[model samples]
Target: MAKTDQAKADKKRQQDKERQRAKRQRDAEKNSSLGIREYRVTLSQTEADALTDLCAYRGGVEPYGAAEFIATLIRRDKQRMEDEKAHLGTCDFCGEPLPTGCKNGLGIPRLKGVEKCFYTRDEKKLRL
Candidate 1:
């Protein structure tokens, strides 16, 4: 009985060591500079159906699937935002549109009466 208990303990320790090693490996891979970050999102039934439909439509043309479709949408939105920001005279530092009274190149206003930029305000809120 004593030998059996010792053997069980040793097996448990070995399993724990293996688990720790695997966790460390996963952490290293996740933090690697070249690794692609993954995001998990929860969607409502209707939203999931819409995404599926969009993927199916693209499937008729090629092998484009849900991930590709989502990526394309994100890229399109980013481009649109960049164009809008350029048209609105976006600031170099914050990538936000310059306020009407902004004299400095920075989107942030130095004038006492001028309000803070939207990005700055949001950042402040996050900090708090």
Candidate 2:
């Protein structure tokens, strides 16, 4: 009876380990498919302390960790930039009205194979 009980316990432990290994493998595959890359950031003692304090202050039922807080900040900044660009209602590159249609919408300069309107300061004059 003792040997049987021990065998059952060992089998259950082995099954649990196998289950955990499978879960980790699945997680790794999912992350790879999503193109998620992990980065290691080193912070000074003061910075780490500040981050901890900020997280604690912002904590409620669910607290924000340092990574979550930083990601949120980045997302907010990106949205703000997009909003500002749209509000301008002009081609970012040529500084002309977007209705005229510029090569690149975001004002980013294309180095190779520059379009005719790329250097044209006044697209309206160029058309006439």
Candidate 3:
């Protein structure tokens, strides 16, 4: 009975190790192609306050809570952009050239690298 218990413990340890290894591999692959950003700026107190207010007004979010909210917003936006790119490989409607994504008709802001489609009736393709 002791030997069987030991065997089970070893199997669990091996499985844990395998899971950790796979996780590390996935992380490495994801980070391998990631880009690094660098920038520098100096702001006076008044300028900072004004900027904060502007960002809040423009983003419809509070500047004081920005750090946490921005992280989540950025992550969500990145995922949304990736999903959009995947879906727009071709036009979502009429199977025409996406050129980019169809604007349909909503006045959505265009992201960099996106092309405006000219042939779709999708509301998402408006104002192209």
Question: Relative to the true structure, how large is the alpha-carbon lDDT of every model?
Answer: 0.67, 0.69, 0.59
For model 1, state the Cα shift of residue 88 in Å: 1.8
Q: State each model's C-alpha RMSD to the native.
A: 8.7, 9.4, 15.5
Tens-digit lDDT string for candidate 2 (50-120): 98887777766677898888787778788876675576476555566544355455564342234544344
Give the per-residue lDDT of model 3 (tens digit) for 92-114: 43344354444344544233234
For each candidate, give its TM-score against the true structure.
0.47, 0.47, 0.29
Most accurate candidate by lDDT: 2
TM-score (C-alpha, index-matched) for candidate 2: 0.47
Which digits, one per residue and each the tens of the lDDT, describe model 1 over residues 1-128?
A: 99999999999999999999999888878778667666798999999998888888877867567788888888988887666556656544545444333445655455433344544443333221
Regions of model 1 farther than 4 Å from truth: 1-31, 90-128
lDDT for model 1 comes to 0.67
Q: In model 2, how large is the Cα lDDT of residue 54?
A: 78
